[model samples]
Target: NYCTPYLGYPYYSSHDEMIHNLYHNDDCMPMRGFYRWHIQDPICFDEDLKVTIQQIGVGYRGLFERQDDVASVAYWYQAEPHNRFPKLPDKEERWPR
Candidate 1:
């Protein structure tokens, strides 16, 4: 979602202006915003296969020449074997809008 960092309609414009996504310190990292859903069971990606397994990551949105630092966390609960991750897109394709 880093390409469209803002979470909703009201906050969309704020991202382009850096109104809410700013760095207070050079060494510190900002917390990734997330949503909560109250339900009887864990979240599922597909209706046919109700499970909690999902993939998540983070990114930074900026101009073509602006190369900023980004950090993220990855947690695993299931013991399923994994496949290789895809190669990252080129710089031009990664430009944030």
Candidate 2:
């Protein structure tokens, strides 16, 4: 025979209270659960040019999913120009077409 309380444990604790107080006082962006493991070499950007592939519409969603896949990232990077944003140069100018 086993006995368990339906109420379970207390909802609020000292640590939780402290954390909530501190959070309310500070202006900080709460951490998100979205994360990706790096599987390829980091993409190097030119400081002078400062050109980046900014995705428009629903394109950003695919970027996070392909963060670990080198081939996919490359493909996306190359396809950036042709996307709805079309920030990058023409397809013929870039590699991995």
Give the TM-score of each candidate. 0.24, 0.16
The weakest ten consecutive residues by lDDT in model 1 span: 6-15
What total of clashing residue pairs does each candidate reach? 0, 0
Top candidate (lDDT): 1
Measured on C-alpha atoms, candidate 2 has an lDDT of 0.38
| Candidate 2 per-residue lDDT over residues 1-97, each given as its tens digit | 2223421222322243335666564454332222232336544554332334443333645533222212222322343445375488877888754
Best-fitting candidate, measured by TM-score? 1
TM-score of 2: 0.16
* Pairs with steric clashes in candidate 1: none
| Residue-pair clashes, model 1 | 0
Q: Which residue runs does candidate 1 get wrong by more than 4 Å? A: 1-41, 46-79
